[model samples]
Target: MPPPARRPVGTVTRGTTNPNRLRRVDRWIGYALGGLLRSAAGSPVVVDLGYGASPVTVLELADRLRGVREDVRVVGVEIDPERVERGRPLADPPWVDFARGGFEVPLPAGLGADARPLVVRAFNVLRQYDEVEVWPAWQRVVDRLAPGGSLVEGTCDELGRLAAWVDVRRGEDGLATPRTLTISLRLAGLETPSVVAERLPKALIHRNVPGERVHTVLGALDRAWERAAPLASFGARQRFVATARSLREDGWPVVDGPARWRLGELSLDWAAVAPS
Candidate 1:
């Protein structure tokens, strides 16, 4: 029999980006995985996979994670050699670096195996691939994570106002499993919760059909959002908080509460929206 098809190693992305366009996701990463980053025996390594035309996001990620892990090492990986070379100048401060690599996440010698990365953030990367390719792509990346490490893959609008991602972790048994699915939106402009369906990670983007799990989750979110409309008289923030709270009360297993919801963020068990 033929061996499994080799996963694609690297491909150039559209290279679109803007500073702070990823703040919501970065904030969530800092909150959810900060402890693991801080607990690394030495400086922790983090990869900003497929960082686009500019290195601004990588710099920002380093700044954010540094608040929790002072010795965090952030490497911005780009498949485009020119982009990688262009970002090299900003790799000073010792704690940050830039390299030409793709989903395989090639790191320097010292940072491999026992010192493998603590986290990999691959936003807006897989959205360009066919829906069927997302699972193999996810598996390839997750397979390289260090034990207890995490892989965050998702997509956000160009301006970063709305986003959704899946968190996958390397289990003790050495298998990768989806842990949670999260959505962050700019509530003020949100018409319906379904607007975020456009930004679901590649894995679930095409799974938004009428009877799919994702569709049901969005339906629930829209209902909760509508039920919270009265609170909009106070502010969008209040309305979002109420909606998130309503989701939790309705058995969605919402992850954070008002503090996170006020930031236009909501996370639920992956089971809630996994393709079914």
Candidate 2:
């Protein structure tokens, strides 16, 4: 089947994006899925779903993924045709392309409807949407994922200082669910880990109520960060690593080791911090 004729995917976004604004998530994508992308059978397709305002993220993604696999193909999709037009001039074909589309995860022209992508990065796109709309959006995008593919959804500050995202992948039942949630902090002049709460993806953002699981995890994290205060003398990196280790020691089900923790990132199975 072909995509809807004269039909576009989803709504137009806020169209606000900055250079390097999505670096942390991009870096995480590299660390988390680069191997899978590298070993894909052929040119692996990646969608920068709702890459707002600029093509920088798309271009940067291609450049970064090319570091893992030369044949990495990236398509920047935006419902705003103007935004797509803005990016088209900047993108290099074959490896990087731009299309006016949305959650349907439309592949560029010349690809079949079955051309599911190996990865879809939709950052800062859902924050403006009603919380109830998130899962439906995820379902739409997830339905387009190639085998072993992923849909990374999240929000970040304008400068990319703090980032939080849910890594959605196929669960044991072969349905998509939030698998891992990762929080990335800049670590420079950082005081507490809870600051990332402000950047949590909308799906989990409001769910940070006092009795909710996310709130519970955050409260514990803040306390552990304070307890690790003595390590501040060694530098923020050490303090963060100690705090992350503390999280694991306290049975938080941390999925990443000290290496990523030292980089001021902590990833855990989303079930551990999911909303009630």
Candidate 3:
């Protein structure tokens, strides 16, 4: 049988990433999966797939993930050979390297045939693709995971203040399943939870309509935020916490509590907000 068709490779993105532009998402990753990162025996590999023109985000991700696992190795993969060539000089530590590759995630052979990556963070990589193409793209990436691995695919603002992503896991059946949806906003500037509608992953971006589960979830979040306005007297953080708490009370299957809410993050089961 023939392999799946390779995705139509696209042009280089603007690749405009600042040092801290992805901090919010990185922090969430560290918090959400630190244990898995720390437990990998021999330097676990992590991929920053589609890291654009600048490799700064990849470097930053390495620095952050290292806090939890000192031996973590990060490979910044770019589809553009020129970008990879440009980033090579910046590879200081041997563990952090830049490679020219697409979603296939090519790595050095001796790293261990069993060395599948624990995490693949593909941020801002799918925003430009047709919404219908996302699932297959996600499947391609998830299929490359090591056992008990995760693929985090999402989009965030240039500065990372507003973002949303879906966590895909390689399930027992070898199929990737969306496990959770996470939204992080800058509470102070948040007018409504739906403001983040623009940052949803490609799979659900087009599903934000009247009867879709994502739309309903956003609507519920907006109403809960409005109902919690009384708590705004304390601060935007307080209001957000109250709002998340309310959603939990209303049976939205909120995943985290006040601690995570304080960071302007809300996570729910994928089933709760996935397109229906």
Candidate 4:
């Protein structure tokens, strides 16, 4: 019946971001979580925690969700006050706005205590935190989610070409329920899908070792990419598509179909990629 305990704002991130750098994840959220937004009981609040220097990604998220559910709202939370100030000029009232906060995911005071967000899209935010610090941060965010809400956190390269993220939901017990690990790449010049290793979320960054589940996933994905070489003439897109299909055929528990694969994205159950 009382308010949740508040946590001090986290440290400022590197604050490096570029236009379109997070387009991959943004598009994924729109297509993947569209149904969740539509069925939301009340107003849906989506948070873009640690949206670096530009508010472009948060704005893009707002735009994407608005296209599906007009009532969707987006709040861009940054630890740097200066970043918040710089992004305020672009705020668009009740739809899209920015505030200074951190992993604590502070909502505007006006929303009242129960205004838990429906989605918290945190990219490149936890990269700086120690791997041991990830779960607690995840708990802090997921604990604030509305029922059926999500906490999507990950890392990506500068140009937005390669990305890897973990999509987590909260359980009735108010703990994380990790669902999937998604790796998206630009197939044009992609040498191998495993190149996404450099962009793994903090949770799996160090876990890409011989004995880790993430390592096993990446290794298998790379091999699958190689075996799909005969499909090259069809196009890199098809090659990646077949690889995703092959992964499922080989019993990797890949969670998506060719529709997402054609976009150079592949998703597997978190248990398949989480540190073992």
| Candidate closest to the true structure, highest lDDT | 4
Local accuracy of candidate 2 as per-residue lDDT tens digits, 124-206: 99998999999889888888899889999999999999999999987667666899899999997998789999999998999
Q: Could you give the C-alpha RMSD of every candidate to the true structure, in order shown?
A: 3.8, 1.8, 3.1, 2.6
Which candidate comes out best when scored by TM-score?
A: 2
TM-score of each: 0.93, 0.96, 0.93, 0.95
Q: Per-residue alpha-carbon lDDT of model 3 for 146-204, expressed as tens digits?
A: 77789999999888888999999987887879999999999986789889998898888
Q: lDDT tens digits, residues 212-275, model 4?
A: 9989888999999999999999999999998998889999999899999999999898889777
Worst 10-residue lDDT window, candidate 3: 5-14
- Against the reference, the lDDT scores of all candidates come to 0.87, 0.88, 0.85, 0.89
Model 1: colliding residue pairs: none
lDDT of 1 by residue, 1-276 (tens): 979634438678898999899999999999989888877787878999999999999999999998998889888888888898889888864588887778788775545555567799999999988887777777778887777889999999999999999999866666678999999999886778779999999999999999999999999999999998888889999898999899899998887778889988999999989898
Give candidate 1 misplaced runs (Cα > 4 Å): 1-8, 109-114
lDDT of 3 at 156: 91
The 10-residue segment with the lowest total lDDT in model 4: 4-13
Q: Rank the candidates by TM-score, best first.
A: 2, 4, 3, 1
Return the TM-score for candidate 2, rounded to 2 decimals: 0.96
Which regions in candidate 3 have their CA more than 4 angstroms from the true location?
A: 1-11, 109-114
Error of 2 at 196 (Å): 0.8
